[model samples]
Target: MLRELEKAEQKWGGANKAIDQWLNNRRNLLVHYCRIAGLPPYENGNSLPSVDNVRSFCEMLVDYVSEGHFEVYNQVVSACEKHGQTSKAVAQQLLPKINDTTDAALDFNDKYTEAADDKVLMQLDSDLSRLGDAMETRFQLEDQLLEVLHTRHS
Candidate 1:
């Protein structure tokens, strides 16, 4: 997973540094999540994920979402327009799914914002699972947009 993200950064980083950085942040967030969920190396241990790790993940999650919505999406739209492509149609088609993903992400953030206790963190397993699915959907949508708006033009 980490290597795949690194390759994506190498491929697309120069085109948009902000998106590259956000991808790197997402990689880190996934690592932290894996540790918390005991997926691999941490699976041998019985310890819960540290609050600091969860906190960092939550913060990065919000930043990634914000950058995607406010910066990266705008850049793609602008690029499509500059290239004489009909960005409006594409944006309109994608808006609903994007908005749904945003809502899910924000809800995840809100749920974890005050999770300082172990009980709260434990309860987050289900929400986090749902978040992982939402993020996958969001990434696929964003990648599709990039393919049309950035890759083709480039």
Candidate 2:
């Protein structure tokens, strides 16, 4: 039983490590997206996108967001819950951050739908700012925990 517990703990540790890395990457992407978001919609090509074009691009972005922040994140959170780990609390706290990111993306979509002169950049900027803000908080929490653990274990 002791060995099993040790293994489980290690696995959870590994999972959280992965999540931290992924979240960092996601945050970076959001920053990058924001940098370009201020460009006008037509700023890309100065032409109106077809319905299909918009739908496909939006779908892809949503899928990407879900896969990273929801799908994989939820899997790790569930594992933590199953193991009765403190990760459960971490996961719960992080969930709202994910929602904030999602909301930003939705807001961008809403504005994109009605943007005049195809200036969709402002909406995209808003969305990225929201997502980046959430990511910053999540990463800070993770870093603080790591520092505490290091102090305790060292």
| Per-model C-alpha RMSD | 2.3, 10.0
Task: Kindly report the root-mean-square deviation of model 1 from the true structure over all alpha carbons.
Answer: 2.3
lDDT for every model?
A: 0.74, 0.49
TM-score of each: 0.83, 0.47
The residue pairs found clashing in candidate 1 are none
lDDT of each residue in 45-108, candidate 2, tens digit only: 4334444444444554565566666556655555656655565666576666656656656655
Q: List model 1 lDDT by residue over 42-83, tens digit each.
A: 683657777777777788889888888888788877777777
Q: Over 4 Å off in model 1, which ranges?
A: 1-7
Roughly what TM-score does model 1 have, to 2 decimal places? 0.83
